[model samples]
Target chain A: MTGMVAAFTATILAAGSTTLLLAVASLVVATILGMGAAFAKLSGNRLLRTIASAYTFVVRGIPDLVVMLLIYYSLPALLNQWIDAMGIDARVEFPPIVAGIATLGLIFGAYMTETFKTALQNIPKGQIEAAIAYGLTRRRMFVCIILPQLIRLALPGFTNNWLVLAKATALVSLIGLQDVMFRAKGAAEATGMPFTFYLIAAGFYLFVTVFSLILLALLARRFEIGLRELAP
Target chain B: MNWDVIAENLPLYAEGAKLTLLLAVVSLALSFVLAVPLAFLRNGRVPAVRYAVLGYTLVFRGTPLLVQLFLVYFGLAQFELIRASVFWPWLSSPMVCVLLTFVLNTTAYSTEIFAGGLRHIPVGEIEAARAYGMSRRAQAFRILIPGMLTRSLPLYGNEMIMMLHATALASTVTLLETTGVARRITLNYYIQFEPYVTAAAIYLTLTFVLVSGFQLIQRRWAGYLESRIG
Candidate 1:
């Protein structure tokens, strides 16, 4: 018990921090990439539309676990070769943390791209025309009229993607990151009580996800205030 | 890029792919079979069943699949009762435990999807059926189930693909599926890119095939429903 307790703080810090860091970085990156992809998807250019469509279709079809594995194991080797060709003696090392974040961001960005694209198309065309008629510049129209509405409309799907992405950080342990699952595995093996340690780990995950869900709900409610007339 | 190494291991990789496909298809079938009844029970007037499904879905959806697989395989082995029971034979096999966990987990998720589909069915249709002298069982089987299945197909297809990717986790429990084989090969050769890429290609191909099959199923089911209505 003392041994488990001794490891508990370190385990929590490593797992919690890594997981939270990955989620925050991925969310930011995913949103930006998603917006780009959304624009590409909605663009008049056939090549841009096809590029975005292909990305969403392929990423959505493939399992995220495969993406994580490929990025973690294969990416560094490919990078190292590139570095060697560039006359750098140092190995182009990709740490597990960076790999996890980048791969997850890439995978989930494909999902969010679709969500944001839907939200973008959902906006009334008349509103954009009205903004244009008012002599609003493209940037001003996007800032004042489009982006806010897109964020509000995309919030629910974005929240869902966030929760899934958080849960997916567990897979990083497979590539040798000492996250919660890694520590839990160690404690379980040492104590010979797999159930107890795993249950604790699972509880922590549930807590994080449930807490995030509550925060998302609050955000949704706050957004709803301006549109309360539609509320019953 | 080592053609010789890949050629030497080609048969082994093929076997791994076979195991992955088997695990996915079997688990998907079992989950779908189990989910329909569970969905029915949850919607029925039974508090015990409803709460049971609620708790089941919460635990399954909330926890990571890796932990769930670990708990079922390793955690249960710690129990003398589980070891001593007649069910021990089935639980002893890693594949069985993986299949069991996958089925139970997917069933919980799909039941929610199924219930949502059920809720979307027009109450007027059921009422009209009753007025036309349709029995409850007949109404449910003929009208409710088919209607729910139609609406639920697309979401269920997504779940199926998710399950395909999920089978990769079975390697954790000593199952030598595709990812499992890739891990072992990577450990041996210390050259990661080739093996991981191979596994990823296999998974990507499977995903493509599964999506296309789902599209066909959707079209076929839609036509069947249309013919019935006509």
Candidate 2:
């Protein structure tokens, strides 16, 4: 029993850490892209709005699995074209990690664009006007006022997005990334007890999700403290 | 760019699309049937049953559907006990496995949606129904279910569309659905872009219909809920 427990713990740590790292990096990439796309979506320029809208619509409409597979299969060819265009002998391999991060980031960024856009809509228009009236520059207004409020308004949705993105990291295994699910699959096949190993994989996911929920709740509570005292 | 290639593959793609629609609609219908009862059970007085349903939903929702599909398809198939069991006949078909996974996954999601709607139902409504001498079962079916359905219809529609997108994962289990057929086309011609682009176009079209359909349902339910208030 002790030996089995040790083996399971080792497997969970081995897989869990890598998957969590990839997921966090992907979340960072997705957050940056999503902010840009959300801004473009809210821009007055019709062309920019249309382009951003199209990206979000198309990406969200398709399955993440399909997007991952397409990217995993096609990114090499796309990169090869760039390498060929540069007229260099240098060849770079797109590892499963790259594919996983890029694809997951790309898809989640589309979803986040909409989430952030909705949050942006909720901010009163007068706040921005008041900032401008106070002689604040556009950058200053965004940094000092708009950005903080936007982040707070979007935190709940963003937390949900982060949860979804974490679960999405499991799809990385489908593309041959040696994440927790991938390692679990290998162990399951080796051990011939598919249920046991898969249950362990599920347990790992539950642990991450529960831990994340607690952290999110704490962050949300911290954000609410002063606001609640001010409320009715 | 090549209309000719798309035209030639039209019928094949349509067949795949038809299969995709069939798989999604059938599974969604099954999911709704399963979810309504499960959602009610989750809210019932029985602690053990409620917790059991909660566990089932969590396990199904927390894990990736791809893993669950694989476990169902290959895991069960590999087992001699399952193979010898009478259930093997239903389990043998790829379509069956896909449908089972789709139904299970969507049921977990929809039960939560339904449960949310159920919670939002005012206690006053139940008290009013009780005052009218409605039986418990009558209150559940007539008042509670209708209120839940009206409140949940829009969210449930979104879940259905999400399930439609999820059906593409069925391709991973070797079911030759739309995406799978698209992959086969790409493999056969060594032309990757056109087939995938075509498949994506088809998916977007389906999503368009899904969104429109959900909007209509939302409008209908809005009228019903408003009428009840009136």
How badly does each model clash, as a count of residue pairs?
0, 0
Each candidate's lDDT (Cα)? 0.84, 0.83
Q: How many Å off is the CA of B62 in candidate 1?
A: 1.0
Q: Residue by residue across B70-149, what tens digits does model 2's lDDT show?
A: 77776676578999999999998888988998898899989988988898899999999999999999999988998888
RMSD list, candidates in order? 2.8, 3.3
Clashes of 2: 0
lDDT of 1 by residue, A1-232 (tens): 7676557645654677766777789888888889899999989999999999888877776667778877876888778877888999987667888888888888889989988999999988998999999999999999999988888899988998898888888888887777787778877787787777777788878888889889999999887776686767
Best by TM-score: 1
Question: How high is the DockQ of candidate 1?
Answer: 0.68
Candidate 1: list runs displaced more than 4 Å.
A2-10, A83-88, A226-228, B223-230
The runs of at least 3 residues in candidate 2 whose Cα sits more than 4 Å from the true structure, single-residue gaps closed, are A1-13, A78-93, A125-140, B1-7, B77-80, B223-230
Question: What share of the reference contacts survives in each candidate?
Answer: 0.69, 0.37
At residue A172, give the lDDT of candidate 2. Answer: 86
